[model samples]
Target: MNKSSLKVVAIGGGTGLSTMLRGIKKYTSDITAIVTVSDNGGGSGILREEMNMVPPGDIRNCLVALANTEPIMKQLLQYRFKEGTLKGQNFGNLFLAALADLSGNFEKAVQVTSNVLAITGKVLPVTLENVQLYATFEDDTCVEGETQIVDYSKAHHKMITNIRLEPRNPKPAEAVIEAIEEAEMILLGPGSLYTSIVPNLLIDEVAQAIRTSRAQKIYIANMMSQPGETTGFTVENHIEELEKYIGVGTIDTVIVNNENIPEEYLKKYMEDGAHMLSFDAQHPIWKLIKRIEAPLVRINHEKEYIRHNQEKLAEYIFDDF
Candidate 1:
């Protein structure tokens, strides 16, 4: 069978989802990336309030990952203004914003951008409705907006107890449901658990579609915990949280990173209260679902960063499961 003929629907936001898309696109061209739009921080946030449009940062990264454009074009898309009021703003995001304005519709702008880039697959925001992300910490104090959730949790040193989309039930894009139904395999995560992954599932229609789809549901576990969001999380804790949103048995497999991090490298993350995900094989969750443990981390010495080894991850997702 032509590998590119396989249908895949990846749901999440941030670099995690975009990084995975980079590798997964090598395996299949029929991918539908359902990205989160609740980010209310940094460049995306600034544009969201000012433009009255879905934040374009996450969407731009996904589009770039799947793009078959020239290296110069890629560089151009990633360029950031070093000074002036746009100091931290990403050019790709601004480009997307301009497209959205010209088209008078965000999705249409993305579609036009996709065509211009000659991307391998489609990208869809999880929802079209204007929505805000809200979170209540274990202390019962709630905050609105995605960035506020992190900042509040950090300031008060509290674990998040729950999160939901503002306005309750934001309707997902029509393509979201169609992609889920056509998907041969549906993948979630590899992003921030609450703000990135869960926010997408918070859409009632999107969650229900995943629950009812016949596709195999898999989760790509994060390599390290987020400082404020998942300070002490273990692999099981992550899965438990996911189950709360999507229901037990909705996830059939989890891809955990068992690769050891160098103590020197681990020190940097540890300083920020993040560490490699700890997993217990004896846990009962294993009896209910399969776990694929491998060296998923790909380190960049020059850049001093770590990301999933895209090719290896994609290979395992196909060969193992």
Candidate 2:
């Protein structure tokens, strides 16, 4: 197959999905990012409460990643205000809110934004309902709202045992199932295990479509454990957690990072109680699925951060595909 023309559907939200989109867009214009909208935190929550629209933060990130615009335009989209009542709010989220008002709906605003930016492919919210995310800790204590879940988990040092969407089984967004049906490849995540990735699957129709699609389903492992959310989780632990919702035998492959992180950066992550997610060769999941481990880490000295090497990661994914 001509990989450049391959139809790809990527699932998840937050920086990871967009980060993957950055690399995948470099290879294929036929990309569709299915982002989560259950975010009730940060600038997104405030805007969502005020605007009564789907949170635009994740959607905006995906649009910027796939955008074919100038660097300045991208910067403008990502720029956040430092002062005023709107301090801490993202310009892109506000842009979407304004577009929502003009377009009469959040979905239409996303579509219009895509056209204006001339972005590659499409970005679809998994569901249209104003969903709430809830997580039950291993101690069986539960918390409502994405923000509270993270804050309480960190404050108490509790592991999340379960997470579900309020008003479960909300309808999937239009064309979402169609995109999955038409896709040649479907990528699950490299994002926050509980909030970014799982909520999408809670929508019955979307998860069902993914299960029945002919597309090769790949779950990209996060570069490291989410410090508070998925602390101490291994690659297999993530897969098992995912299977709790999607069922077994759904994932055909798992792609993980095997590269060594620089000690200085590793120490920084360690300070935050996060660690690189490594694999156990003897894990039984290996018997049922294909595993690809490669050097996928890239250091950003300017930002003093480490992230997936987008181009390298996409090359490896397509190579496996």
Candidate 3:
């Protein structure tokens, strides 16, 4: 089959999902983003609280990433309001909220929004129902919600024991299942390990589908450890944690950053309890690692902090896949 005919299903949320989608969409039109819906912060949080809807921030990010619009249009979609009363409101998030309201269905809202924006590929919520994430620490302490779990982990400096979706069971969207079954490749994160990647696995059907599918599964590890969530974690620990949630030998390959980060930034991250993801040649999983000397080590636009360079990232993801 030709490259464009290769279907792909990417799972995760936050900037990682968007970053991978921006890259993969360039290779194939058959892209489906199965995003996490556990966010309870920012504009998506406000809308979720008021309307009792699934958090829209992650979904909004995926929409913009897959959008086929010009650079200016992408900028506009990502533009945030910085004024009294409506400060830090993202245009794309609000637009998605409004569409959800109008359609009276979150899934339909995503479909309508993607079509209206002329996005290059399909974007989907990992689950359609309003759901919350809960985590149990290695100490057996329990925490509810993604935000709370991070706060608990930060204060305790413990690894997460397990995570599950509230309500325990949810019907996976038929489209999501179809995409997974039909995909030639499935990409997991470079996102928050506990908050983004693990939550997707918490769903029984989603996990089962992934296990049964024949797609080549690749995990793109994050360059920097997240504070509280993955403090002092190595590239091996990242893979180990993924296995804890998704089962062993689930990842066929891993892509890690090989570039060196500056000491100044490293100090700042360390203060936040973050660590650089170390790739050790002696490690058992080292043979599966594909190191990309990515300049993802630097800041972007002074405000966005760090981001993967789109053009270079796109080329590499396809090259490896």
Evaluated with lDDT, which candidate comes out highest? 2
Per-candidate count of clashing residue pairs (backbone under 3 Å): 0, 0, 0
Worst 10 residues of 3 by lDDT: 289-298
Error of 2 at 199 (Å): 0.7
Q: List, residue by residue over 1-321, the lDDT tens digit for candidate 1.
A: 567788999999998999999988988889999999998899988989999899998999999999998888888888999999899999999999998999899999999989988999999999877799999888888899998887776666678888988889888886899999889899998999998899999988888889889998999999998877898899999999988877888899999998888787788878767778899999999999899998898888887677899888898887654
Q: Write the residue-wise lDDT of candidate 3 on 1-321 in tens digits.
A: 588878888999988888778777878998889998888877888888898888888888888888987788778878899997779988877777787889888888888878877998788888877788888888999898788888888888887767888878788765888888888888888799989998888888888778778888888888888876787788889888887666677777777777777677677767777788887768777666544545555466456356555566666667776
Weakest lDDT window of 10 consecutive positions for candidate 2 = 149-158
In model 2, state the lDDT of residue 116.
78
Report RMSD for candidate 3: 2.2
For 139-255, candidate 2 gives per-residue lDDT tens digits of 899899988987886677789877888987888988899999999999999888998899999888888888888899999998888766888789999998888777898899999
- By lDDT, the better pick of 2 and 3 is 2
Clashing pairs in 3: none
